[model samples]
Target: MTILIPAMTQAENHPVSLTDDRGKTIELAQPATRPAAISTFGADVSVALGRQPVAITTFGLQGVPAYLGPEMEKIPSLGPRHQPNLEQLSRIAPDLVFAIRRYTEKDGPQIEAIAPMVAMDLITLQDSLDAVALAGDALGRPQQAREINQRFKARLDSLAARSPGNRTVAILTSGGETPFVYYDHFLTASLLERLHFDNVGGSPPNPESGIPLGYRISLEALLALNPDVILLLPSNRQRGFTVNPVWPYLQAVKNDQVFEVGQHWKESAGPIARSLVLDDIERLLLPDDTPLKTSSR
Candidate 1:
């Protein structure tokens, strides 16, 4: 017979006990409950752990994906991860808040006053997997979290096996006057890297201010790259709802190699979204004799 015990919490000034990546003891004020995920990645972790957050940071106009098991829509919107709404957050009265350390550090005192806040470090794929596990443990749902991690790894392996080598790919943000090129470290670039595609160049120099969080490139720069495949992320604007003006000119566009990525797949970090991203990339990278529609726009 198996026995279940309540999750552990750290005593006052006694160091909240948790294990790090290296299996070192990590101390915090208490176990996480009623968590407010300050980033999409953190929200993914919370959802995987079976604890529905009271509030979550928003992504864009499309909002959270419908397939996040339907409980997502009920959570109160706390605005963007980069810029959280303190007023809404205060009303939620979260017991713990999980966010990227870089973004949360500045508002530490303010957030801590409402509740104990912990900064999660999720840089690489490994880091993300570990963070998920940690979140599961904190939320008393370790088994479910491990299963999700295992499934994701298995899917990644399958994608790697089916992928063709030496395909040059580029990720672009569209719907504006000028399309933008994404850097290697961005989430979309990370997804492409998993499928063994090569990003054409390094990050763009000094992307425009307040143009989302990516590097911008001119049409001339995109043509210079000469990629075999192009993945376009649409904006939440009127122009995005209609046709793409620059689609007819590019090499990939001319060759019918352009593919449209949905907002949920490109933006969210949860299991379902990641799986969709993997499937989309597989369809593009694998050689199928059937000629399908080029643009989903």
Candidate 2:
């Protein structure tokens, strides 16, 4: 923690007590009225929870994706995650700062100089939902967060109830030249697990690194698994699959089962993003014989 962080407490001191994913507790004079999120993910959550922080991180601010809508572009941005402009940040007069452990671990002390911080585990599926709750608490809107989470879970429950039950799928991302299969604990994969879709992600979350791992499976490895469906993120078009030498022979490739997705898959935790993910799962992965479930719970 940074030396700049204010000494926090309740009663005679800061009025509200909040605990982050790292188990670090912070006491706020009151619920934050003007917060600054440290990343695009945090910014999206703020809007989803109806708070819409005044400041967001610099990197990827433009790439916040269409799902976040126009408000994303309206907010001012801090410097990169590792180093933000403290003088500029102070000018914003933010009451609170929200960040993930990835950023907090490296820059917590420096960021603390601007405002007290709430750093949480937001890299995976479970963390994302937790982040929504934290944002709600920070903004004094816990009920809204609860309602949103319940709705998200209910939608998943509906999907699970109507799932085909015995199908395998693989997620591929266009963030790189060759699509890499995401690990089981990644946001989208976790949603797939909830929907009862058999996942082919051979990797899992790495405990030491505190990061969910992804592997760019070779053509031979992909051929061996031959998952029933291949979800393509960042790009929905599947014609690019032809670049791989054995792409034409893959089952998902041949059967027209390759589905394209948007930023929601990448941002599995955002309220709106997760909702879209469920929508896509129902539209693309479910069996034609299965009755479609309404997106609304």
Candidate 3:
């Protein structure tokens, strides 16, 4: 429904030629049946389209996410996303591997030795949808992908129409002496904005590096934002950072609106991940009396 998926683009044909976000043309001898994803994003999209990856890119000590629940236990790990284990991947012998465009640029030549790779950029919602549609073609599930896309667009439209005004939110990234305030280039803040939540912090200055969680700001600047809701990343309720003696006057801390969520909201840029993020927000923002249509998938 978003039209991000070009009507003329068809990957099912032999010698499929598709250009990734980096403008690299991915030429496939045939559509990949047994595929592999170089990151959690690719793996999640695969599962959403009703096909599981033979292997998923791992994150060293961090490991991959359990997006598929019980099905997660069945999938094998393929090492780190950026610097994958080519030896292990060769054994898996996948027909193709999906990768983040930026990370795979330098390693393209080497990765192709293991299996042809298709790189994608997950910068915005449309980008994620495009990647999903591409995956649908590769997995021979184009109809399923279109249905999911239509469903997602409807859900998003519903939220935009129903989102309340003046409910400002601020996101704090965990790590460093002072946790960073995330505005843009991250799923949580961006998606919340789409749902009509006013993000007081705004998006980060630069989004490509993916190193810094967000721009670190003094407590005074954060207080100036006066956000009604505060979301903390990589946080736990037991840590009790919100209840600390730091700021008794902060509205969010005083009102107990500070919440901690799993890493999916902060990282893992993909279509399925966005859907999961919307689910999380609807749970938190919607009220029992709020007369909005439920958009849960």
Clashes of each: 1, 2, 2
- How many clashes would you count in candidate 3? 2
Q: Model 3: runs farther than 4 Å from truth?
A: 1-15, 59-62, 204-213, 235-245, 291-297
Alpha-carbon TM-score of each model against the true structure: 0.76, 0.84, 0.84
lDDT of 3 by residue, 1-297 (tens): 121234555656544556666666666665677888887777887888777788888654547776656676677777778887777788889888888877677888888898878787765666677887777766667788878888988887876666664589888864544557875555567677777678877756665544344677666677777789988766433333344456567788889887777667755466667787778787877554665646442
lDDT of each: 0.65, 0.73, 0.71
Candidate 2 segments whose C-alpha is farther than 4 A from its true place: 1-14, 58-62, 79-87, 174-178, 203-210, 235-242, 287-297
Residue-by-residue lDDT tens digits, candidate 2, 211-232: 7558777767888998988888
Locate the minimum summed-lDDT window of 10 residues in model 2: 1-10
Residue 28's lDDT in candidate 1? 50
Model 1 per-residue lDDT tens digits across residues 1-297: 011223453232333445543333444554566888787766777776667888888777666656565788888988877778888999999877777655676776787788666565454455566677666656656678789989988877666665664777787775766666766555557667766778764543443221234566766676778788887776775433124555466677778887877765454455556666777777766765423423321
Candidate 1, which segments miss by more than 4 Å at Cα? 1-30, 121-123, 201-214, 238-247, 287-297
lDDT of 3: 0.71
Query: 193, model 1: CA deviation in Å?
Result: 2.2
